[model samples]
Each structure stands twice: as C-alpha cells, then as structure tokens.
Target: MQKIVDTAKGLEGLKRQWGVHAAGVILSRDPLVDVLPIHKREQDGAIITQWDMGACESIGLLKMDFLGLRNLTILDDCLDAIRENRGEDVVLEQLPLDDKPTYELLARGDTLGVFQFDGGPMRALLRSMIPDNFEDISAVGALYRPGPMGANAHNEYADRKNNRKPVVPIHPELAESLADILGDTYGLIVYQEQVMAIAQKVAGYTLGKADLLRRAMGKKKKEILDKEFQPFSAGMKEQGYTDAAIKTLWDILVPFSDYAFNKAHSAAYGVVSYWTAYLKANYPAEYMSGLLTSVGDDKDKSAVYLAECRRMGIKVLPPDVNESMARFAAVGQDIRFGLAAVRNVGTNVVEAIRRCRKEKGAYTDFYDFLRKVDAVACNKKTIESLIKAGAFDSMGHPRKGLLAIHADAIDSFLDIKRNEAVGQYDLFGDAFGGGDDAVGAGMVVTPQIPAGEWDKGDLLTFEREMLGLYVSDHPLFGVEHVLTAAADMTIGALAEESSVGDGAVVTLAGILSGVQRRITKQGRAWASATLEDLGGAVEVLFFPNTYEIVGQYIAEDAIVVVKGRVDRRDDQPRLMAMDMSLPDITAADEVKPVVLALPRPGARRRWSSGCARC
Candidate 1:
C-alpha cells in the first residue's frame, strides 16, 4: 500500500498522457511550440499541446470553447423546409423583437420543439415567467442552469418580470449606469457579462479590466480579487461614488458572479429559441418535419415529436413510396414519415428511390414502379419493407394487396422488360434490336387487390414494425388525458426523470408493446412487458406473484397503467410492477387489487429481477 501510494503520488498532477478537450481550444500569436509544449495527438494525429487549457490561458493565450448544437442543424432544416413549402424567405433579422404570438406560445409552455426552453424545468419556468418580450426570453436562457435555476433564481426572475415583485436597484447612486442594462432582469446579475457591464458602469472599470474582474470573481481567487478591488474601488471614488455605495455594489457582485452566465451565449441561444417558437407558431408542419427528421433514428424521440405533431393538428402519414423521401418532409400541411426511418430500409435504397422520384415524377402505381426502377436496388425485401411501412398505400390498394402482388407482380413486370430486351423478335430481322418502341409499350395489367381491408391492429403493427413507432395511430391516442391522470407520469416524462434513485415509486401509462414470459429459479412464471404510449416506452417487470395477480391485464395493444418502484439496475430505468390497471377504470375495480411488493420499512429484501426496456 505504501509503494502504490508513492507511485500514485508521482503520477498525480503530472501530464502522464495527452487527451483532446472536446470544447477547449488554445490560441496564441506566436508559434505554439515557442509558447507551450506541443505535440501530435496520437489518436487523430492533430497538432496539440501538452499544457492544459488553463495553463495556456495563464501564459497570455486565448482559449475559446465552441458549443456543439444539434438544434442549429434542426433550425437550418426547418428554415429550408419553410422556404420550400411557403415560397418566402423568412428573414430572421426582420422578425419583430416583441412578437406577441411568439411570446404567447412560449408563455403557454408549448415548447416541445423549441430550442433551449423545451426541457421540463425550463417549460415550468416559462409558464411562471410568462415572458412578454425578447429580454425575458434571453434572461430565461441565462437562468435555466444548474446554478441559477437550482438557487431558485427563476422564481425571483418570474416575480420581477411579472410585476409580482418590484425591480430593486443594486445601488441608488449607480442606478443610471445599471438601469438600461439590468432593468429587464430585475437587477439580478443573471449573466457573467452583466458583472463586467456592472463593473464598468458602477465601479468605473474599463471594459478589458472589468472582464478580468469578472474572471477573478468567477475563479474566486483572493490575490486576483484583491488586485481587482483596488482599481474598482478607486475608479468608483474617482467617479464621485461614496465608499458605502461601492461596498454595497461589490458585495452583490461576489456571490452572483459564480453562477452568472455569459450574456452573448445566452442571447444567441435565446434567438434560437425564438426562431423555433416562430417556426412552430406559423409553419408547424415544416418545423415538426425537421424535428422528426432530427430524431428519426431514435424511436423514443420520434414518438415524442410525432405526438407533439398530432397535438399541433398536423397529420403524420406513414412512409409512402410515391411521396416519402430520404428524410421527413411536409406535404402541404401533413408530415410524411421518411423512408429512411423504416426498419430494414437501407440508406442506399432510400437514395435510389428518392433519386428516381426526382428524375421522373412519383411512381406510376406499383408495377410501373417495379418495371422502371433498378430491380437489384429495390428488391423483393425492399418492396416488402415498403409494403409493411404502408408506402404502397397510394397505389390504390391496401398494404396486404401490395404484399400479395410483389411475389408475382415484380416478376411479370420484369418479364415484360426482359422480353422487350429482345425487341419482340419473332424470327424476323426487323425485330432484332432492343427498341424504345417495345419498351414503352411494355405494360402489365394491374393485379386484383384483396377485397378485405387489413385489420387496424395488423396495419398499425406493420407500421410500428417498420417505423419503430405507430404512424397512423397509437393504441392510447385519445385516452392520453385519462392515462395521464391515472398514471403518476407519462412514459416520456419518466424517461426524462429516469435518473431518480432506484426503488423510487412511479406510475406510468402506455400500451403493452411487447410481453415476454419466463420461468424463475423457483419454477414460478413471470412476465416482462413493454408499456408504451404516445410519450415513450418503458419496461415493466411482473414477478410471479404480481403476474399471477394481474396476468390478464397484461396484453399487447391494451392501454394499462403501470404502478411500480423504479428499478434502475440497468443503464436504462425500468418499472418493477406492483400494480397494473386499465385506463378509465378505478384501481378497486381491477380484477385483483394492486399488491405491490414494496420493501418493508425494517426489511432489506428486494422484489424483482432486472428488466430490459423495449
């Protein structure tokens, strides 16, 4: 142990290895080697330094962090979609700063697709803030963080913004310097840049030195703070400020500076938030199309956004071979689910299909499509996938009919094209060439479609199979409100707050997407069911006792309430079922009342096995 301690002590604080900083970058006017110890990153072979970012900064170098944002891509896609659909370039700069509809949308907390303000806590803050303009929006971006939001700064912000509390000045003498800048935020220093601005205004510090002052305050270094205070106090005294006023101002700066955000970054995010709100307010279909595309690969995320689309009265069509593209797109006012999102649908195939659609018009029914396209690219498997995704519904037939035809129709269509390759030769010289004449005339009769319509359960099942989500309808669509009330939380909400400690009690509602039975070590039967609704999906473990007590309640496509303690044994959280009941039915009305195996107050026994989320 003593030898190991000595080795670790030698290793500690030493640059034992080099690693890339995700956001940190070092800048210097001179050659990097002259300024700091430099090297090539072994992993990527990029030029890097052995010195840490802070070390580089301390030695007269600039280090800037670049925040990677997925929303920026989403916003760009939304704007491009808007322009394509609306035929107007929506000038972002020309937008009204105090747009009423935008603020109204924000205040109502309908920020599912909005940037920076879509999270649960942020939305809750928005509801109380009831922001009327851009300033409040900017303040929201700055305050909704672990520091300010945790400190309940949002409450004070809301109170001041809503006129519930008066905007208190930092100091009567410095009010003029502070008023214009801090007026909107109720004089609370919510931004780091505000500290600099406040120092410049109240303490008469130059912008550069004021920035240094902010840096010192953020680091809370006594030596730097002591040096910064001299010029700050002296400058305030030179500006005819009394010592008492300066002391009061400096006292406020110390604590608030720790959590204060950078106004520039916050305002940038705030502008993005407004842009998202604007898109949602006016071009909802386009906005949702972008949102859906952004999360197309994630079924859970796609489901949440799709639900939001439905709530916005936008119809989401399943992947259509005729209209669907490689990415989610808005057709008129409805969002078409992308073919790329379809399970087993390859990107190459999607590209091929989209390229073909762009080259010619939409496919001329199933057989015309079958005959014209590359048979190798869009093979039987691809056709089957398209059918399952309801992509062939636009061909004047049900998906089942398309399925029936693909087995024979593709061959017959190919045969016509094959026969045309020989130019309809009948032992004559004139017919001995591959001609457009024969190829153009090659047409097969449309095969008879099945008379019966595919069952709704089967159709939705197919859509779910292909899209990883129900496109036409979900099992618990209309009863969302009832389910919401019955369950302690929705599947989506549960997913967001899944970091809660294990054995935490929670109730959630969703259709039984899947159910798998197993035999325990004790030879007792148990089941694990996937409870999924519009919001999201969660796994529920029903042990032998719970399974036997309410086994009938657990069936596929049935909207059931799951009451259980959170089993966060896995990376993903799952609910160990203690209770299960259908929506609109009272718990007492259930066949067998809920008998949860909650750990007794003085006991140490555990209930169920670990679960896998669906």
Candidate 2:
C-alpha cells in the first residue's frame, strides 16, 4: 500500500504527453525558430509551438487566441444573400443598436437561430428581462452562467429590470461611489470589469493594482488576497467608509469573481445576438436562407430551422432542379431548398447540374434532364436521389413517373454516348437529331410512363428519406385536429421552460421518428424517440415500466399520443412517457344530447304518442 501511494504521488505532476491548443497562437517580434522550437501537427500540417500558452506568456512572448465562430460566417452569408436577393447592402456593424423590432423579437423569445440567445433558459431570461437596449443584452449574456444563475442573480436582474424588485446597493455608505460602476447591471457584480472598477472607485486603488486584485479574486489566490486585504480596507477607511461597509462589499466580491464574465467579451457576443435578431425580424426569408445553407449538412438542425421558417409564415419549397442553386436561395417571400442538401447528392453533381442548367436552358422534362446533365457526374444514384427528393417535380412530371423511367433513361443515354465514343453512326439517324434546336423539337416524343402518384404517407416518407425532412407535406397533415384534440399542448409550447414546470404531467401527440430501442443492465427493454408535430419535435423516453405498455406502439413513422412528465434535467426539455396510444380519428364515443323543435304546443304530446305506438 505504501509503495502504491508513493508511485501515484510520483506520477501526479509528471509530463504525460504533448498536445496543441485549439486556437492559441504565440506572437513575437523576433524569429520564432530563433526564440523557441516549433513543429507541424501530423493531422493538418499546421505549425505549433513547443511550449504551452502559460510558458510562452511567462517567457514574455505575447499569446493571442483567434477564435473561429460559425455564427460569424452565418452573418456574412446572410448579408451577402440580402444583397443578391434584395439588391440591398446590409452592414452589420452599422445596424442601429436601438432597433425596436429587434428588441420586440428578442422579448417575444423568438430567437431559435439567434446567436448566444437561442437556448431555452436564455430565451426565458430574455422574455423576463424584456431587454430594450444593447446593455441589457450584454448583462443577460454575462449573468446566464452557473455562478450567477446558481446565486439567483439572473432572476433578480430580471425582476429589478422589470420594476418588480428594488435595486439595492451592496452597502449604503459605498452606494454612491459604486453606482456608476454597477449601474448597468442593476447593482449586481456581474462582470470582472465591474469588480476592478469597484476596487478603483471605492478603495482608491490604482488601475494596475485593481486589475491585480480582480485577477486574485477570480483565481481565488489566497496568498495575494490576504496580502491585499489590509491595503484595500485601509484605502476604504481613508475614503471615509466604515468597517461594516468595507466588509459587506468584500463579501459580495469574493464569490462573484469566480464566474464574473469580462464585459468586453459579453458585449461582443451581444452585438452578434442583436445582428441575428435584427435580420430575422426585418428580413426573415433572406436571413433564413443563409442560416439554412450554413447548416445544410446537419439534418436535425435543418429540421429545427425549417420549423422556425414555418412559424414565420415563410414557405420552404422542395429542391427543384430547374430553380435550386448549389446552396439554399431566397425567392420572393419563400426559400428554395438547395440540391447539395440531398442525402446522396454530391457537390460535383450539384456543380455539374448548375453548369448544365446555366449553359443550356431549363430541363423540359425528366428525359431532357438526363440528356442535358453530365453523364459522368449525374449517375444512377445521383439521378435517383434527385428524383426521390422531388427535384424534378417542377418539370411537370410526378416523382412516381420519373422514378419509373429514370433507370431506362440513364441506360439509353449511356448507350448513345458509348456508341458515339466508338465512332458508330447515330442510333436514331436524324429521327432524334442532335443540337439544341433538335433537342427542343424532340420534347414532343419524350417517354412518358403512366404511373400513378404515390400516397401522401409514401411521398412524405420518400422525401424524408432523400431530403432528411418532409418538405412537401407531413404525415400528420389530415389528423391535426385529432392530435390537437388529444394533446394537452404542442411540442413547441412544451419547449419553453415557463410554459410547463419540471415533472409536471402533460399529454402530447406527434409522429414518432428516430426511434431507438435498447436494453438495460437488468435485460429490460427501453426505448427513445423524437415526437415531431407541425410546430416542432420533442424527445420522448420510455423506461422499462412504461416500455412494457408503450413499446409496441413506438416505431418509426408511427403517429402516437404520449402522456408524460416534463424532464427538465438537461438544457432542453424531454418527455418521460408514462403511457402511449395511436391517434384514433374514427373513434366517436361521446353522447351529445339531441334537441328537437316543436312547431306547436301539442307537438311534443303527439310525438310521444307516436313513439309509444311504434
């Protein structure tokens, strides 16, 4: 036992391995090779320093972080889209900070894709705070973390900002001195900058010394804190503050410094949050087009955004080979889905299709499309995927008919190309002649199959399979009334933290998707699935007990009504399903009373006599 303890202690602080920081870089005026050793990472062949950030800083080499944020890219894409579609240039930096519509959108908790303000808890806080200016946005961003949230600082800020609670000072004697520093945060020490400001203002510490004190408090450096305590109290006393006020001010700063965010960082994020909100409120379709293109490869995120689009009264049309670009585009009051977002479609094929469309005219029909598209890029799988995703719907042919003849069309085109490659004569020999004019004339004889359209369920299933979502229609289309009548609330409504309390019982109905069945350690079956309705989707969990009764009904594409309790254990709410059932629109068991009108006073007596005789 003693040897094991000594061995563990010896290994505790030893250098185990070498790794690189994700975004940190060391900047120096001198040559890097002359000052320190460097090497390239094996994965991407990027140069990295031999020492860590702290070592570089200790050696007086300046270290900086260059963060790459996807939201920033989304903002750029949105602005570019606005220019292309609307012919109007939008500069994000020049946007008005006091935009009324932006604040209204934020206050309504409509920030599904807004940066830094999309989470459920953050949205709830925004609704409560009703932020009217940029400062409130910055303060909300700083106060949303674990430290401030744990201390109920977020709720207190909301209440005080909304005039429901009073903004009390840390100490009466120091209130006037600290008011200017803490005024924006409603007398709460929400930022590390505020702590430094307080130290400089009330305790008469120099800027450099106050910054040191802020760092010491944030890192909880006991030695430095103890060393600085005497001077801080003495400075306050010299400023005519009493001992009690000094102690009270110190008490609040100690714990808050642990998680107080930097004001500059929070304000920067607030700028981005406001930009997204502004664009979404004023230019929804254009902004959503860029937003969708940004996350085009992520199916779940695309679905969430599509639901938001629906809520905003913007129609998202399915991918059309004649209309879609490589990325999602915004039409007038609508968004056209991008072809690159299709499951089996590749970028090469998308580029080929676009190039062909731009050079030649629009595809007259499915046959014309096969003839015009690049044979090498648009192969069997690509054509089939495009067909199934409803990309050919605008060519005036049903997806079912296109699916029926797409294989033969591809094979025939390939055969003709093969014959041409071998220097053989044309197969049709001027009957179906070459050149763009002949091709236009040959459209009359294009092959047409007499296949019927698929049912709504099968059509939507194919769309979902190919496009990763049901674009044209959903499975719960006709039965919405039944689901609404059975469900206690929509899945979207349940997503709001204030709409339903944790562990509160509620009923919901939607089509089950992404169902996963698993077995527990005790060999009992459990399952999880995403219940998606018109508004949105929610995760539903079935434990062993509930699974016994509901497992049979839980399957992919099954429309179900789930009775469950809200599970708010995670950032998003989930459903702990207690019972489940299939929606039954045919079931009518209600006993509604029938009323019959009597024309005369004796009509009731005559009807009764007639009923008795019968």
Candidate 3:
C-alpha cells in the first residue's frame, strides 16, 4: 500500500507530461530566455515554462497563480439570475457563515451544486459528521481526499471533532504551543503550516529554516533527515524537553509530511464549499439553473444534476418556444430547459427564435412563428428537432402534429417571404397585424392539430432521441417503481458498468427497443434487443436457448424484467439473458422468494442463475 501511494504521488509531477502550472505567470527583470527555457502551452498557445513552478521557484524567480474557478462562475450566474427574476442583488460572499439553514442543508447531504463537497463519499461524511459550523465544513474538504484519507482518519477526526473522542497530544508539555493551531483539528497534523509552526516552537528553529525543515520532511530523504535531526533534538533539549518527548512528536511529523495539506489553500476551498452550500440552501432555483447550464452538453451529468434539482423540489420544465432562452433559465421558482440541449438544434436557430420572441411578444402559434422567423435558420431539420424536444408543446400542438407539418410550415412561410420581396402586399393596409388586408392576396394558414397525445413509446422515444434523455416520461414509467425495487441492477448500471464485473449475473427492468432476431448458422434462433430505462440503456442478447423460451417477450416497446450475465467480452459490454418475464407487480411475494442473493453487497446487487425475474 505504501509503495502504491508513493507510485501514485510520483505521477503528480509528470501527470501534465512535462507541463507548467495552469495559471503560473513568471515575471523576470531580465529577458525570459536568459532565465529559463520556455514554450507555448499546447492547449491554449500561452507562453509557459518548460519546468514546473517548484523548479522555477528554486531558481530564484517569482511565480503567480491565477486560477479560474467554476464555482465562482456558477455563483455569479446564480446572482445575476436572482437580480433578473426577483429584482434582488443577492450578495452571497457577504452572507454570514453562521447561517443555520446552510448548515442544516449540509447535514442532509443535499450539496449537488456545491463545490468540493458533492462527491458520494463526501456526502456520506457530511451526513455522519453533521457539520454545525464553518470550520467543520472546511475540515471535511481538506480531509476527504485520497492522500489524506486512510486508517480511520475520517472517523478519528469526526469523532474528536464532535467530542466523541478525546483530544490528545504527543506530549503534555507540547499542548500549550500546539493548542491554538490544532485545537480545532483534534490535535491531528492536517496542514503544512502546522508542521512549520510546530518545528519553530518545539525545536527553537527560525521560521525560514523551519520551512526548509518542512521541505526535507516532505521529501523523506534519509540523508537530509540524518543531517537535520541532530539540530532538531539539540534545540528541543535546550528548551528543556526530554529525548522521549522529541521522538514522540517527531514520529508523527514523519508520516504527516507526506500529504499534509497547505492550511491557506484548504481554508480557501473550504469557504467556497460552504458558500456553495449556502447558495443551494437559499436560492435553489437560481443555483440549479446555472448548474444545469454548466453541464448541459453532457447527458449523464445532466441527468444526475436534474435529479438533484427534483430532490430540491425545483421543477424542470421542457423547453418552450414561447418562453425558453438560449440556456437554462429560472422561471419564477422553476428552471426552464434550454434549447441548446436539443440535439441538432443549431445556435443560429436558437438566436433567431430568441430575437423574434423578444421583438414580437410571445409566439401566438406555430404558423405565426414560421411566418416571421428566419427561414434560413428555421429549416426542416431544425423544426423537426424543436418539435421532438417539445419546444412547440406550449403552442397547443402535440409534437407529432408539429413534426408532421414542419416542412409544410417552412414551405408556406418561404413562399410568402418571396412574394413580399416581389411587392405583393396591399399598399392601402397597415404594415403589421391588419388581418387579411395586410397582404393583397395572401392568407395566414394555421396547421390542423389533433386533440390527443402521441403514443407513449413514440413520445418518449422522440424526447430521448432529440433531448439526450426522457423528459416527459420514461418508457418504463408504469412498472419501473416496482421493478427497480425488485431487480438486481438497473439498465443504467449495466450500461455504465459503474461497479459491476464482467460475466456477472444481473437483473434489470427496461422498455425493449431495436429488436433484431435471426436464425443461427446451425438453424437455431437468436435475438438482440436494446433495453433502456431513464438513467441509461444496455443491449440484452438472447442465445438460442433463452430466445426460444422468451421469444414472445422480445419485441420493441415491450417492458420486461430479465436476469442475465453481463458479457464484458465485447468492446461495449452487453447482457446475456439467463431468465426473463414480463413485469408483474402482484408477483413480488413469489419472485422475492426465488431471487438468489449473490455475493455482491449493499444497494447494488449482482445476480446468478438462481436469481429470479420480477
């Protein structure tokens, strides 16, 4: 384990492949060429050093770090939205750190949009620690990382923090010098600044020399330790401390120097974490609007954050041509989906729509929009995408009707535009909104819209196809609740393979689509079907034997619960069915009895042959 850690830590310097600091800008009194070798960053074409910040610092040059944080941008967006929608300038940075509501929200682990505190393990830690103050929030961020996390450090720190474990020091005499710095950290050596402070106070070393001591300890060099220990022990002896006291304190420092976080950096990040939690607690809609916008292009991440928004009781409506913006927007207390998320809906189309809506109030109907909107921007493909994403749903037309009439609408609008260019309008009529007199022989035609919704499968498939996810409803919405509770793993888990192993048995409930069946070379029958639920999708392959047994259920748009082995041999893993059946809610009592409990543990279940279907 120690070797593994050292190997992982060694890669930190090489991870960027001989790259320089992200925002390090070095200023020199002399020409840059006279000081060091330089090159432009490959990613952004900025001038940078061939050596890292440490090497530059050692060579007597100043390095300044200017980092652009995503959380700051998220906060800025949230504040701007608040000012626009609610007419109040919310000064998040100026808010008090002692807010009870923020702490309570943190305790519930509802920090989906918060910086540095939203990981699964960190959320669990927050739930257990129940942070009541700002200091604890900061400490969790500093301690939750991989390097500093081991040997029950989290438990020890949390226990000591909440008074479940007593604080103890290396020596009773050292407590007076250490209490001010480490009292809040449960006497644990959590920061490099504390290492410098302890070295100065206990060993009579000057602060500058103590920093060198800090460096020597961090490197774990045997020669440097041999050269430095005599001075450290001699200074402590002069301070009237015994030899045993010196060893006890020095022993703790040895392991700590490996990964002790810098105090200033940890505190800064911790405060940002708390600030984001505060924003999530107070202005959920505005904060999630920015959060959704930041990850709009990524389907999986968008799904996760949208679920978080729902958990916060913030409704996420589908895109609306009448009211939607280019990016996600806050509509009173809810977040309105953005048009940019729809697949193939280009930037020009969104801009044209926004411009038209801004100049001419909300769109009256579909045909009205097509007549005035730019035909170059609003083409067949763009119109189809808009309809599939439900942007026209608010205009009193179902997606199917709009999809069917999109080409007709665009053609009619373009014909009118060509005639208007040719001077076809009535000279005696008003320029706009004067009924039939506005155009000499022209008439506005509204497309006929049916009164019923489309087939559930078609509606959801189109939504998932164009918007990257199912917004109105999932294909398996009817029995998903019962099947999800009874299944071994979800379709999402099988597709993502988050923690499932190759060739492991699993059970899932999903709407089957894209069914392909054929006769094998040996004259046996086989089939493959795509089973998809809201979170994700996976392919279920039925070999001859299983296909013969479940052939009736292998069809598009049919929801089935299946127990299978995840076949990881393929480049993209697939599920090989072991057993299958239609989802029957009333059979929960019968199915649970036969479902085999595999060795896999916790909320995620892996299956075996004995596992039964729902």
Reference-based TM-score of each model: 0.82, 0.84, 0.79
Whichever of 2 and 3 has more lDDT, that candidate is 2
- Number of the top-ranking candidate, with TM-score as the measure: 2
Superposition TM-score, candidate 1 onto the true structure: 0.82
Cα deviation of 73 in candidate 1 (Å)?
1.8
Q: Candidate 1 residues 513-547, lDDT tens each?
A: 77888999999989998888887778889999899
Error of 3 at 123 (Å): 0.4
Candidate 2, 482-550: lDDT as tens digits? 888899988877877778899999999989988999999999999999998877788999999999987
Q: Write candidate 3's Cα lDDT for 1-614 as tens digits.
A: 99999998988766556645667788788998999999877688988777778888888898887899988888888888888778998776688999988988887776766898766666777876778887787677767754457535676787777677898876887888789878878887777888888888888899998999888987888898888889999999999888888998887777677776787888899888887888788888988999888887767567767766765678888998888888888999999988888888888888888887787667777876776566555578888888888888887887877777778767766666666667675454466555332422246465676567789778888887888777766655445567777587655445553458897888888778779999989999999987776555678889999988989878888878888988888767788998898876665444443444323121134343335553
Better of 1 and 2 by TM-score: 2
Query: How many residue pairs clash in model 1?
Result: 1
- Model 2's lDDT to the true fold? 0.84
**lDDT comparison, 1 vs 3, better candidate:** 1
Residue 43's C-alpha lDDT in candidate 1? 73
- Give the alpha-carbon lDDT of every model: 0.77, 0.84, 0.77
Candidate 1 lDDT (Cα, whole model)? 0.77
Badly placed stretches (over 4 Å) of model 2 are: 1-9, 221-224, 421-433, 436-446, 478-508, 514-530, 534-547, 563-578, 583-614
lDDT minimum window of 10 residues, candidate 1: 600-609
